[model samples]
Target chain A: MGALSWAALSLPAKPPGLAKASLDRLGESGVAHPVTAVLLNYRGYDTLLEVGVLLLALAGAWSLGRGEQPAENPQSRPLLLSLLRVLLPMLLLAAGHLLWIGAFAPGGAFQGGALLGGALVLLILGGLARRALKRERCLRAGLALGVLVFAGIAAVTMALTGGLLQYPPGAGGALILVIETAAMVSIGLALGLLYLGGQPPEGARRSLLATPPDHA
Target chain B: MIWRSFDWFLLLAIVGLGWRSLNDRDLFRAVIQFIAFGLLAAVAWVRLRAPDVALAEAAVGSGLTGALLLSALARMRRREQQAVPPRTEASE
Candidate 1:
């Protein structure tokens, strides 16, 4: 019965509300990707708040308890290390490409950041990267950078344009790109930290696996 | 017709998996089933023509969430083992 009802429903001839109008003028919004335009321009304030929520979630997770200490000088299997050496670069490249294309295609800051987060988790699992309390300042800055940049841009644009988050004419694209790059970095770092679940111990061990033979 | 049938099958699979995951007795098995459900949900998102949602579901939903769940489960298991030894030794 539920399936039948779902099947019976038909898509509207045109999108409801302002979405159609927004879609029509999306290109002029300085983003080729309509979704990006909607997310970062038409409704940018929401996205900014969403990034804040991600940071808030991290804070909550951290408050739950300190995570178990990671092993010191942890060693990965030579094969796994070699595989990661090859894989990590490709993942980084893909993340970069996703961020770059987000302005014109289906990719965006969130997707790119998530991929980067996945890569960071892989590195952590492989013992190539360790969370360290000493690095908390840097990590916190990275996590907050997106929201800080976004709010700063909005405030500056508001002063210039007399409207919140309204980018000046002819500069919308550049500003959005700047915000997206900052957002991508913050999102990536925030997600990575969230996966770590709690404050890392001081001086956590770094990966000490020997370099693969073929690389030498 | 074939596409419609495929969608139906996909929907049923999602529902079945969700039910199984929720009702599974073992925490580890439940977590694994939940991850499987997440992957299927990604497929369903793709079928709904929302690639962005599908990507998020696949990456954050299945990948990261699954990792978090498994780690939490491991910690719980370790605590249980620690608790059991003391109690069992006392009883013996």
Candidate 2:
């Protein structure tokens, strides 16, 4: 999905077409393409590990934003805001393409998603205050839901195939694609919010609601 | 071919920019140079084959941190503006 988006946007520039090349090379044998093999090897476990790194960034960003709830005043303008719109989707596509190509080369799910997360962070900083205003609970629920879905998939795999995060070898390609696609959305959302600077309006309102009334 | 050796050049740029950014005499120049350092660092990540790290570096390094620094610069400018009081004595 990202790769397709990238291709659509990068129309004239036309960065190297790894997907076409990789697809053509599928008719051959072992580790033929350095880029794809680096990405796709071991059904993309390496990519998963790299994604954990971005997860760490999310953790780190989240930790830094404590003790204050910065309110969103819709008045903040081009203070790094407009660029967010232009850069984000392009970054997503680039990351996706890179990760997909990595299935044959050095790109992997983790690296690609991290790039997407990075773009997300840029957007947040550029002042897309969406999640920091009203989307807090829905966003958290989304993160929890992602974990549940991943766990459910793994459990079902274990029940049917006696192993978790495991898919039949012949179906590895399709399975990896499915996992990567799901993970792209799940991981990107968490990391984007983590990098966002402050609490959404609801969380702030909730905290205010939690405070006991001042004693007379 | 030159682009392939982009990693080495990128590292060199990062080191040079980092050193200048940390030690420059002018505070404003130092901050701008720090952003350059980040851009170089991103290039290095690309060379290292970690697009993930590169992207994060670009965002946090240049985007967020850079904005923070620029805000500080703005405040400093306003302070300087106020500090240079109106000509009360006489014109040179």
Q: lDDT by residue for model 1 over A31-66, one digit each (tens)? A: 888888889888899999999999898889888877
Global lDDT for candidate 1? Answer: 0.83
How high is the TM-score of chain B in model 1? 0.90
Fnat per candidate, as a fraction, reads: 0.54, 0.04
10 residues in a row with least lDDT, candidate 1 chain A: A199-208
Ten-residue segment with the worst summed lDDT in candidate 1 chain B?
B70-79
The DockQ score of candidate 2 comes to 0.12
What is each model's TM-score for chain A? 0.84, 0.57
TM-score of each: 0.86, 0.55
> How much does candidate 1 score in TM-score?
0.86
